[model samples]
Target: MQFQPIYYDGELLLPKIELHMASCQAIGIVTDVKRKQLLMDQLVDHSNYYLFQAQQAEYMRLTVEELITFLNKITERNERVTSLMDYFALKEERKVKIKDLSPSKRMYVTLMRVFFAHQPTLVLEEPYFYLEEQDRRQLKRILEDLSKEKQILILTSNLEDAMISCDVIYRLNEFGFYPLDIRDSEEDKQEVLEQDQANITIQKISTKRNEKVILFNPPEIDYIESIEGSILVHVGGENYDCALTLTELEHRLLNFGFFRCHRSYIVNLQKVREIITWTKNSYSLRLNTDQDAVVPLSRSKLQELKALLNI
Candidate 1:
């Protein structure tokens, strides 16, 4: 997808990273706060070539149902508000006022409305900020659905968020946007393979419940998550404290389908029913267990997880 060389205030912004309008979802990681703001202005503000500014773009100005009715009157194409609500998991908060809604919730409704109006492009600034893990996953799915016909540009300082949502990614800097390395290097791949083959035995894991130690098989554990320096193991719809850290367990259980999905979580891929979109920055893997457990997924590991799941 080659784009015409684009310039912003006499600086090159495109062709360094080509963006096509055919269902393209692109993300730019700008760690520098100043650069991120500058890039946002360049992408979201109107230009000679890209005239649709973010503020001028369509967004939710009314309730979900009302917005749908309004769209039905203006556009020739009919879009269902019920479906949009379901897609964004807004069924529970359908009646909530826009002011009463949380930041993440408001963002979800904004995204739904923007896409329902069939806007050709969406320019978002730090879209994943403060989003919960579950909402992040839903937003990812929504962007994917919208990308079939619309272009999405996400600007954020979080690299993982960019990796999760964008088809083509770049880093914003003083020079311009530069393509980022998303693939594991050859040496790193070899190291992963060697690590995968070397240790396959993790017969049992020890955990304490109420200060009583219990042992469980590696296969019996659904997932392991670490929160705030404390490691917890999930098995049989229960959580127990494990002596081993997430890193230690991830290495021991690699052959057992346990993969590091996030910095705080290692999941048994075989138990994952589906990947839940939390936001553009975060993800969740829903387990097929009795409790329907979910594990955190990091943006940086998005491709690795997809490859592992064969998605």
Candidate 2:
């Protein structure tokens, strides 16, 4: 299905979107919240699309089993509630009212409506944002199964979540919409290794935008994230494709106060203003930037970070 260009507030939110959803595979569009909302709204206007929005209304008064039964009855499906409960891994909580379940569990139960959807195309918004790991796996599995017969479209603000279930992924923002290359081949792995063997020759990190190479000084970079075998150099509020591996960039930017904070992230310490402790062991570094960027600080690296700052 193709959508015409969309504009909101005199700014283009999306260009011509031509999407051909393949069967047995989910397609994801990694976009910002506003754009995701806009796209979802447009999908809602289409009667052939089944939109499963985040925090969609649920039967809070009904027990988990009752809710599933009601959905089955209304959809006129023959699948028994017991099997559905087991498939959703809700057998243990079947008797619990939707309101009594935890936020994650409730959202998981609410998502059951998708499995019974009659639409030929299913569109979901941030399906993994509020889910726990176990629930995420279950949902991914169900979506994969559903994709065998239905065209699935997942709209998420997170690339990681999209990678979990999407066979093909695209990124859309103000800069423009484009496909993200998440595939890793032997050549790509060799290139990374070859980069690791090279010494830092320059301080300016090279990145690409719109098929043009752009060099950035280390200080101007907010952080570098390695996502699904792709290196993204983030600056200000935008990100660009990077050819160099994180290890090479880390070695090049070490003299400029960049810290390898996580397995997949390297942050510019000069931009870090707060060490947020979300849990006893989970930590994040909040950047002092206009966009309020935050990156995860691995548990194993916390002590090293504290030692570096003399905390």
Candidate 3:
């Protein structure tokens, strides 16, 4: 399916997207809630798409096995409920009512619709967000197996969640949708390298907002982000377009208590209030800000950050 470009008051919101999803690949799009809703709005009215939203409603009175049986009956799938329950690792909770399971387990049960969806494309929103590690593993395994038969598209706000199951990942923001390089292999890292060049000293960052140029001192900035290859200067609670590249910004901000926390993010160490470990490798830096700002921290950089802060 093809999606035309979307614009808002002369600014580009979403670029034209052409989907080719028949390669047994599960595509993941990491985006904010509003954009995810925008994409969902376009697919919700279509019959060829099965949209599994984050807050999907379930029959609270029905048991897990009953719900699976019902879905199989309605979808005309002949898969044995007992077999599916075992495959889903829900045999222990098979007799438990939907409302009785833990929040994580309940969400996992709600995510079972993907297995029975008749639509040509399965669009799942944050399927792993509320799931526990075991449930997450089960879902990832299920999604991988399902990808061979249907077009599976995952939409989530977390890159780490997307990385869990998706074969191909894309980042969608106001700038445009672009593929992200989340590969851990050194070969993939080398593919993204640029030729080394001399850097110049910079004190203030120049950004553009509403056709007006705004200059912010290095100390005033909270973090710098790279979205779709566009540098954005984030200050206070707002972001402005920056002409400089992330590498350039890194060089400029290197001496201002800033750390390259992730491949796409740079954070001011002075503002880092907490190091939130989602997993041993997946982590985030919570900033000491009023709006509860957080940034992704790469596992490869964790040791570097520890040394920088003497932690």
Candidate 4:
């Protein structure tokens, strides 16, 4: 006895192909080198004229190397090219290994989706996966920078990083997409106010007379020194001890006139009375209060701060 085989003929297959092509168009698919070559081969196959026509009508094939070269030519900075190259490397590595791509590449692809997709809204899940601490910070900066260009929707479980990076945050509970928090300049101001209130409470508790406070409001603070995990906020004539870590203080006071000039210090921008070029790679910040502090500036941030201050 012969067995009959289940089959999908041209009628059924055409609809499936159309649906797949539409899905691919919606999401902006990126094919690896092998898949791209296979697509091209199928497009040129005389036996599958329908597939060939579909490929020609729906998509274009380009090598990752060619795409990198094109991007390098149009991009202005060496850093952008470096980032693109890193992404290309990871893409190739993933093809060879058939495993998870590097976090940097994943970030790059997500960014590309945002750039190329027609939709104004995009969502990213677990974006920080496989990234180093420094890379994660860089990714946050990149995302923050990109937000100026487009509205992004990110779904992340990392609360601290999300707080640092997002303007508005939401949580998924039984109620669905609850607005958990909104952090903007106002939040930053409230944080500063709460910090000041806490400081007042501490002073009242300790009765420290020489403890400092801000007499006149400044545009920005350059750096605050960290002593034994506590931040020393230098204002008019004295140092005010605050029970905040240097990073936390920087985040809280950044909108109020503080900038992270070093890992251990955050400075007031308006209080930067003068900047002494300490060396080719470093500088010293002189405050309006006649106090000087040395802070290490990375080459990139040094240029950025100079442009920001117009110094």
TM-score of each: 0.49, 0.69, 0.71, 0.30
Tens-place lDDT digits, model 4, residues 1-311: 01122124422211111111211111111222332233334333233221111111110233344444444454433336446546433344323221243435444433443333333333444445445555555566555555554444443444333444454544432222234322212112223334443433221111122553333233423345654465565554455665657655555555675676655567777766766542354354556654434343444456667887777
Q: Any runs in candidate 4 off by more than 4 Å, and if so which?
A: 1-118, 182-311
lDDT of each: 0.65, 0.83, 0.83, 0.42
Instruction: Give the better candidate number (3 or 4) by lDDT.
Output: 3
Error of 1 at 185 (Å): 7.7
lDDT per residue, candidate 1, 32-138, as tens digits?
66655544445533422232222333344566556555655576566576875676687887776665677666665555544544446666666666567677778
In the predicted model 1, the residue pairs found to clash are 23-147, 134-278, 135-278, 136-277, 136-278, 136-279, 137-277, 137-278, 137-279, 138-277
Tell me the tens digit of each residue's lDDT in model 3 across 142-228: 998888888999999987688777767888987578887554322115233463655855577899999999999988889888866
> Can you write out model 2's per-residue Cα lDDT over 258-280, one digit (the tens) per residue?
99888778999999999865436
Off by over 4 Å in 3: 4-15, 22-24, 30-38, 41-48, 73-83, 128-138, 156-164, 167-203, 211-220, 270-311
Highest lDDT, which number?
Answer: 3
Error of 2 at 84 (Å): 1.4
